[model samples]
Target chain A: MQNKMIGYVMILAMLLFGGLSTVQAADGAKATNPEAAKVEKMIADADKARKKAASVEGEWRDVGKMLKKAKAALAKGDYKTAKKLAAKAKSQGEMGYKQAVAQKDLKMPSYLKY
Target chain B: MKHLLKKIAMLAVAGGIAASAQASPEADREAFQNFYKNRFASVPMEEYPNGVYSIDPVGRENWEAIEEFPPYEPFIDEGQAMWEKPFANGKTYKDCFADGPAIAGIYPLWDKKNGMVITLPLALNKCREANGEKPLKYKKGSINDILSYIAYESRGQKTNVIIPKDDPRALAAYEKGKKFYYTRRGQLNFSCANCHLQNAGMNIRADRLGPALGHTTHFPVYRSKWGTVGTLHRRVTGCNKQVRAKPFKAQGEQYRNLEYFLTYMSNGLELNGPGARK
Candidate 1:
């Protein structure tokens, strides 16, 4: 009877672990290609932001290069690197735009003051 | 109550000063001229076209020596030849200018029709295009040579840029140019005035800075560093890069407007281009 109890406990433990492994497999699949659609949206948004900034003559250096590289990485299915570069490019472009706007009403230096 | 009144009085004074500081082209010219004169009491106004050499005795001596056998002489000769040379249409540069003496000083004009500043180089290119010849590059080589000759011929003509009040666009362009002159940009965050105006006659390492008062008087300067003649725009580009800013295209609208603003500031100064400089 004790041996029979031991067999039942083993069966229960196996069932619990087997269910957990299945969930783990699903999580592993999610991790390998996690949020690819979200990363693509981020890249698209960054590209638009950069273009808007450039139209007003507020382009900063390396933003274009970064974007291009990001797109290239995305094409190669390297979503992690692509998303990082795109985000950086977007930030740089936004800063450039802000700078151009601020310069429009720039204060003249005291020496330049009449 | 007394302190508050005092603050109000100070604010009024500040407002008055600010109102005066919105400089008109005419007012700016007068003020800039006075500022330079006051700063360099020893140097004669006419000698300002000599740039840094005017303020530095050692630099002047060296410049004078270079002038004795001016390295730019060959460029002038070459430019004169090109000027006289006929295009495929058998038309010459004289056809473009109507045989006018080199009018370098009267340029960067507000073209009311085109709604743009017509610089000497741009006009030259337009002339070339009309005659079915390819336009020359704006920065260096044969273009620089041609400008050097024109500037040499127009030497002593006073810089007299006009921003006609008839057109609102003209004023806007002038204001834009003025803003650009003062706006700090690039990684270094230096404006054109930082080196040329505020730090004028001061040295940054081995280089002595020139004043902005007569900045536009000379162009197509034969810089030893370049080992060739360079135009005012080229010098401006170099200055922009030195301040870590991305340079605009030579003869682009931004530069043309800047030229217009600077030339206006140098009203009454003589043109002495194709100059030699270190």
Candidate 2:
């Protein structure tokens, strides 16, 4: 009776593992580890978030106005506020103004190094 | 008195003409300033640019004998030998791709189906591995060596990197690259685009800014300053160092994605190996 139970347990374990193998093996020949798939998914999620954020089109004009102000502050050597505003503005602009500009799909400013 | 007045009249008219001539350039510049917010077809800033990658036909200043950093002859030659050497699979690196000189422009591309970002260096080593050969080492490895060797091969391909939007992988990589540039890294917390692209033709202290265009061509350049044939990532590391940030390793995906982004920024620039820069 004990031997039969052991045999039954062995079969169950194989079935469980085989079910998992079938799911994982779906990617075909490539190893396609779960971790790698997870990473790929995370990347995809990030991309989706970025695209959705891009489409919403927030108030970048506020940033353009703020950037104009920041530039003015910087030119006046208000280094403290200029730096703070630049930082604050960058976060705001990085997402907003940047998205519009990127969406404009403007040529990278020619002066920039690729 | 009459002759002097006549001379004055002529001088006045000449002055007006000269003023207009001088103002013409500035006037045109001002006129076009925002006409096209993105005036030219912008290249991606992650890897290399697009459209017929070739070296700048600009005159080159060869540094064949600079001692502080010998032209990367040593590294370049080493790379050449590695390229010709057979892999365990009996295939030369040359056999894995089309002629090396014309292949520099295929990288920093997106493949929608694969959802993967492929950079030039990764592709080179990938070909080797596909032929039942070992992947070349990234830094101080066969892969790194092949870059210079392959750079020699890429001598004349037109810079043409096409980022296919349809490819989820390509688009994803492009976005990754774009973020990498804008995201401030390093202790200084500056983005690569901050100094290089936006401020092209400006200066970092005494160094003159280069227009980011045509940058893709100069990789594996023999920097007389460094005496090494550098991969694009090494340059990225150098940029990090300048900003006081701890640099990433040569083979990290971050750099690869950055390369993709940078190269994409160069959408229509040429790819010249080992171009001279200050």
Best by lDDT: 1
**Please, what's the RMSD in Å of model 1?**
11.4
> Where does model 1 sit among the CAPRI classes?
incorrect
- B210-262 in candidate 2: lDDT tens per residue? 54455566776555466456677777778776764446567566676767655
CAPRI grade of model 2: incorrect
DockQ of 1: 0.18
Query: How much does each candidate deviate from the true structure in C-alpha RMSD?
Result: 11.4, 18.0
Candidate 2, B37: how far from true, in Å? 12
What does candidate 1's lDDT look like per residue over A1-114, in tens digits? 753654465456447786454334323333454565567678788888777766665656567788888866664456789889999988877776777777765565566436
Off by over 4 Å in 2: A1-114, B1-70, B98-101, B111-114, B131-134, B141-144
